[model samples]
Target chain A: MSTEANRLPTATLPGGHLDCTGCTHRTDDWKTGPTATFLGLLLFIVYSTAAAFQGEHYMYENYLSPMYSPVVFTQLERTVTTPEGETLKVAIPGAAPVEHAWFGLKPDAWPEWLPFSPAFLILAFPGAFRFTCYYYRKAYYRSFWANPIGCAVGPFRRGLYRGETHLLLFQNLHRYALYFAIVFIGILYYDAYMGFFRHGEFGVGLGSIVLLLNATFLACYTFGCHSFRHLVGGRLNWFSKSPLAHALWKRASFLNERHMFFAWLSLFWVGFTDFFVRATSMGWIPDISTWG
Target chain B: MAERTFEIWRGDRSGGEFKEYTEEVDEGMVVLDMLHRIQARQANDLSIRWNCKAGKCGSCSMEINGMPRLACMTRMNQLPAEGKIKVQPMKTFPLIKDLVTDVSWNYRQNERIRPFKPPAPDSDGKYRFQQADADRVQEFRKCIECFLCQNTCHVLRDHRKQEHFVGPRFMIRVASLEMHPLDTDDRIPDLKNEFGSGWCNITRCCTEVCPESINITDNGIIPMKERVVDRYYDPVARILRAITGGGKKLPTA
Candidate 1:
């Protein structure tokens, strides 16, 4: 052992430095992963921003974009020519009267202080939930923040990391945000219910299916939450005593294993739901109904 | 007679190269068995560290086929028979010899965590804790100190942020101590500062490589993070605690 110790090199390699120049240990898939994440998030941001601003195209018949669901307020009025060629002017509560027939819920005018889209008002809840999601925290931290960019990869920020300690202390609100997300799931499901009713009679349309899928995907993402698993049965000593919570936790754990998949799936499908409503509402696509 | 080829690292700290050896391996034999055979039949100076061959001691941690795992637990049948399996010392730590990395850094880290100390005994002159409360920390105690989580942790492995970040093994250590029901020492400040619980990004890589299947990230790190947040970040909680002198109290058992 003494001889072996003597044979060992005396020089030790220095670590924990702030420099990341030309590090050799970065993963092979490093560039591709961040590039995809950057592009994907960027696409969602640009599309969602534009769709939020283009408020006229967010609703078709009873179908609504999950983004602008439970319309708190609207500043929209339009002139519509029905299939029978009768023109009518309809105005939502917040906007000036114009020659159009408006559909769906019309609430009191949005306070003049908040100027953007109605979608902007409600999206923050889900966005905060995703921003602080355990899986999404890794995704954005690696891809967007470039903090040690990938698993064993060279990172942009090299030195001491605070890691949601101080500046991102609000991230601790994730469990609280789960409450909002759960409530939104119910709201969106309500919209899905509204989607199936055109003129108070039961009807199924392509837009209804889109809204249904948006609710399903969002439910998967929300139910698969790590905090939900903890809230259900994480600290329990015996699973046998509380079988219902244990079973729910087992199901949540099963879903938590695929949390990443559901996260991406919900993100994409929510975006698609917005696009579908926008396109059909603007006459870019026909609202093909089963009965009609 | 199935002959499996092994590409083993064979040198010291300065440099090394993969030296190939073809060994006749048996069914139900693990990679450690082949290494023992090579040490006995071919090279006597082949150095490797192991104690309990049943995967409990955690002294046998090495990278097999570029994955950090215990050699004794890895069955030969699980490996692809066609390619040469490489056994290298864990890249996270300094190497001393062939297949033996100097893991003394881990022991030093283990020392940083404050051990459990039960408060002064009750009126009966004995410490008491409910089985339910003890069971809360029992899951984290399953760690065998294999340091696989330490070796696999990205903050330590890739960034080499050892000075700032305590790896996953010691996170479990800190979690075990902090969750003890009868223990009444607060380690949250140290966890935030010296132990570097904040540096963990909750990637679950450590939990994935854990041989004990301990939920190191979800159960240990995240909960500790919540405690840190409750103490340091939540202004209302902090102010209320300042007024009430209550912070992260275990229910009286």
Candidate 2:
């Protein structure tokens, strides 16, 4: 069978149809969508990277930054002399003390060359989860990869497109990454719960509310994940017999519809929560609380 | 009543240009109505393919102001109050004449899809799936086959991967069947390889431009991709199937 015979005579317009980026017939402003996505994702990446490496100001009283949740090991509250002979503060203000760390003090095997942050231990799980997300795939593919730039717009690369078939085959592991994400959601909720108690005294603070909302938004995003939707209800062929699965599938479908909304909301709120914790810890903002 | 200008693409596969037509716009005129008036008054030979002018027949699909939309469904009030309403044939397929493209390519693609094959009826000699089961695939049945999704899909529109990808419309068709409780045929291998499911980057232009507002990417294509992953990519699932000698006997391509 001749595949060429199936092809029709394409339009003689400039750039043809596929490469017609500057075609005058296009009346919609196509650049705005991809431009917004590019700037939004770029901002998130930069802010998250700086916050993760800072290692300090991640905790304020009982509130921990979502970036540094499931704190693995913490260093002692003491000043250290740097290689430059400058005094560096090892004790971060408002951070959970070494006693509060799940595994206690930082190990002696810790390399001197590497800067340690609790975020380094756990950020990968959530980061990989988002990177491989079905929604984020669309977001970054259009914005960053310029796969088509916009719906009808021409792409930057003109070569044969492999899409997610080749090197991106690892994207198939998104469901596995989702398991890690679900686990992280549980850890985040625990952190949020810890935020409600300051030194074992039940209390409400601006920081506590911030942490709680962060957990809620992240929960909405994680639960609304496409992979989660498939796992809960999509895999079943017989919804008639499986009443419970059908019910959960319906709920998941509802959230799945708003997955993109929750994705951006959770992303922005997580960054804001980190900033709020950092601000209060650094004495830049006051944490109004019953503990006061 | 108000005067509105339309820049409708005129001509055929040989050549074409946007020919401007100014007409009187009524209170509740749709783009299709304006096109009819223009065809009646100015260019009597002006060509457009439409039926059921109520947007249900899935005809009269064209690029309105650079967005793929059904002309009958797009009201003049919904568009910018000022500016020429640009109307053009769906760019993905070959142009035949003004506002009409050779959409037979879509029909050929449709013919390639395997038809729904439900399992044999029970002892009562009747299908017994609940409404809940039918409701899921019913969303896909809402598709009017406008091929607006095919037009808007960058995989077909920009990348011209029609030889590779089957576009979004057929993906949902396969999803509707695959997710059917009684359907036993397996198209997973074809979905990954021949159908070029991977070609879809999930940019979701198909969902956005869909007149039916189908969640084509999140609900349909992504689920299909996950199934392909389960069959071909998942190592744990493969190991489990190996150890237990348990897995569906997928039909060989």
Candidate 3:
């Protein structure tokens, strides 16, 4: 008897149990359904289409009213001086009382290797496309493709690739990527610091500083990631006796644990910070004070 | 006093579907409690998977009304009685009978991660570790292997990219051990190339659904990604790699 059966006694489910919703007695193996995967494909289609068309309806925004912080949506209108010197009202919002992203004056693309800017977007495309994934193939097959609901493949019982190739011979990119991620975080920190006191006063703003900190944490966590270490040489199957190498690895792993936490906090905070800035610029939140 | 409806799945691998039944309900009952009622008073041989119904073992994860949740912890009162509760197996793994999936593969992946072997201990066999050092790793070990995060992640839940990506849950496991201050194995390269660590776009659905509140992406996945970048893309490191014939010569622990 499997652990599951041992834990459960024979019982009747009239109104039924959640775990037994689609269950039967064939507990030893798994099957698949391409139809379920197709359904998942369909869901993606709907989602992507919605995303494409959701760009902007006149570039207007939803913001809280100064008078009623959480309960109201107020429209922000802004005027900016054009390169030709005439100030005009642009439906798009996002400008502090005296500050602006100056997007109209921004460069289209800097370089293919620059981080977060249009540069990295263009550069990362090749890698992204090359690594088109298969994370939920089993689920899609069962849930959406209308295929038989079961495991696509059984447990592994073979050689290196058959299991997780411990002594990964050619997988070093993950570690390399980590250092650059750290550097990226450092640059973001610099950007935040530059913005922090650039105005000669101790407070150019803490908003950017906070963003920098979030970036810093994400960068640190990403550097400490296991994937990178794996690529670097985590699978050195013959080096079990080497003390120093093992020591660095333990240290890396330690940081990586903290990495997971900061990675998330930063991901969420970045989105929120972006939204907050946009709201403040568009006249949503009046004068976000310079205090920390 | 009240009759509740259950939508149970009634088919096997070849083909099957949801079969509903209505029965009397009770107070302070959980979804698992209802299923037990069904199995005892209704279907005598019905198969369901669970253990430690207190939500500790993670054996009872299922789609409760379209959301990934622990059925044992789901209170019937919290659900809308106006509709039939939809329960399904975790979409990311292979389903066995119904809600049970072939999560055994995850366990195998867990083993693939080099087990923790501390660096040479000081003289004697015993070693000492500071509480501050072990605190964070212990926190990550709280995961019960529920795979709910894997089930709800759009990448694994909708996109079939397992061949190229290991889900956030496994990444969390790797991170947990890697973070152990005394662990003596390197896992970064395997994380990048073999495990397909870069596939996570950080949507963080895994982080969102984690019952343990572990930050799979921020604390685990991104850090791994950053390390990968450091190895291959960082100019100085790349030059060093070229000069040193790759950095694999370094020993772990």
Q: Grade the docking of candidate 1.
A: incorrect
Residue ranges of candidate 1 with Cα displaced over 4 Å: A1-50, A70-73, A77-117, A142-170, A202-213, A216-220, A227-258, A282-292, B119-135, B239-245, B248-253
Please say which candidate is ahead in TM-score: 2 or 3: 2
The residue-level lDDT of candidate 1 at B239 comes to 83
TM-score of each: 0.76, 0.92, 0.52
**Cα miss at B10, model 3 (Å)?**
1.9
Per-residue lDDT of candidate 1, residues A108-213 (tens digit): 4545354546676678888889989988887788778777465444456556566665587677767788999999999889889888997788989988888898
The B-chain TM-score of model 3 reads 0.88
Q: Which run of 10 residues does model 1 chain A get worst, by summed lDDT?
A: A1-10
Residue B8 Cα positional deviation in candidate 3, in Å, after optimal superposition: 2.2
Best by TM-score: 2
lDDT tens string, model 3, B1-253?
7777766665444444566656677998998888778878877666678999898999988766656778898898877766565555665666677556677867766677777767788788877766645554676788888888877654454445667667788887777766666776677788877777755555455775677788776556655555565554456766877886765423223
Is 1 or 2 the stronger prediction by lDDT? 2
Could you list the CA RMSD of all candidates, in the order they appear? 6.9, 5.2, 12.8
What TM-score quantifies how close candidate 3 is to the native fold?
A: 0.52
Query: Residue A54 deviation, candidate 3, in Å?
Result: 24
Cα misplacement distance, residue B54 of candidate 3 (Å)? 1.1
**Mind giving the per-residue lDDT tens digits that candidate 1 earns over B17-126?**
56777789887999999999998887689999999999899999987875678999999988875877777787788888889888999999888878787879989998
